[model samples]
Target: MFDKYLIDVATLRNTGPADAPTGFAFEAKLGYYRGLGLSMIEKLDVSIDGEQLPREAVRFDEGNGPLSLDEMETAYDRRWPFGTPATILIERPGGFPPGEHELSLLQQLRVSYLPFPSTNSDAKSVSFPG
Candidate 1:
């Protein structure tokens, strides 16, 4: 139900030092109705224009500072509140060039009542900031 808002287009931009960006990022809202802790995130895969980024090249931050995918595994204290957008950053050395490209996010989250983790994903064509 919250898939449409998974990625906020306005927040998509290059990140890191202004003079030499190390990556690109966008704000991503949880697709679930309720919030979940960072530890409950079982999977988070990112791809741009059909090319999947390496597992170690992604990081997540919901205002608690940036954490690598591995660090998020034990971040039980960090909670991703409902309706709040987290920044999903990708390390691309110089960030993506300015233009329209397909950005995709796939996430698997463990929930209390469900026997299996819930999977949510969304993709959209967005223009990268110059």
Candidate 2:
């Protein structure tokens, strides 16, 4: 069955000042499931207002290691432990314009219990700092 599976946007920070960085911080509550040996997540897409950002600029941290979009495909050890929080960061230079914007994400996850990989995509509204 498909589900949100702990994928959620925990917090958002708007851009401020001239030299400040604007980005989105996300949290994934990965946990142990019956019969699942490990959870491997690779497909991660982050976009702002329909504009897709480069995966290379997205940062994914799973405590075991830090990986970017560039290494996502090659990184085989990207797994989260049970009941642990995984962090994902996407920073945009110049920051987002002050106002309401749509934040979207698509994640592809694999598990031993499932025959195929499961995908989760979600979007929500966010306001950047003025």
Candidate 3:
């Protein structure tokens, strides 16, 4: 049987002068399979204006660690079970042009028994400078 999970965009902030900081928060509810033993593979993808941002594999509950924003991708093997809630935050670089920008959050879940990882799920998008 497959397990249920969720990918939520807890918050988004744009800190710059002239342009007010835009914040967004949302949650995604879904399901997946419960893996065996003590490790589950998870991947998170963040993009802005269709361009991928640099991200490091860090605990969702814990803020971005020592890794810089140029790391590209973040992957990790967790000891948590399926259906766990993970929160993510995406911060835009300062000086973003005064216009609408598309922000997307993509997530992938993998189980131990499954040969290949599950399909990517699309949560929702937020527009800034509206």
Angstrom error at residue 93, model 3? 3.1
Worst 10 residues of 3 by lDDT: 63-72
Candidate 1, position 39, lDDT: 92
Candidate 2 residue-wise lDDT, 1-130, digit = tens:
2235555544554433456756556665543342122236656787888988887768777776667766655665455566566676777765555678887777676766789876767677766564
Score residue 48 of candidate 1 by CA lDDT.
86
Question: How many clashes (backbone atoms < 3 Å, residues ≥3 apart in a chain or on different chains) does model 1 have?
Answer: 0
lDDT of 1: 0.89
Instruction: List model 1 lDDT by residue over 1-130, tens digit each.
Output: 8888888878888888888889999899998999999999988898989888998999999998999999999998999999998999999988866788888898899998999989999998987667
lDDT of the candidates, in the order given? 0.89, 0.62, 0.43
Q: How do all models score by TM-score?
A: 0.93, 0.67, 0.50
Choose the strongest candidate by TM-score: 1
- Of the pair 1 and 3, which is ahead by TM-score? 1
Best candidate, lDDT: 1
Once fitted onto the true fold, the runs of candidate 3 whose alpha carbons sit more than 4 angstroms away are: 1-10, 14-39, 57-59, 62-85, 95-99
* Pairs in steric clash, model 3: 3-31, 3-32, 3-33, 4-31, 5-30, 5-31, 54-72
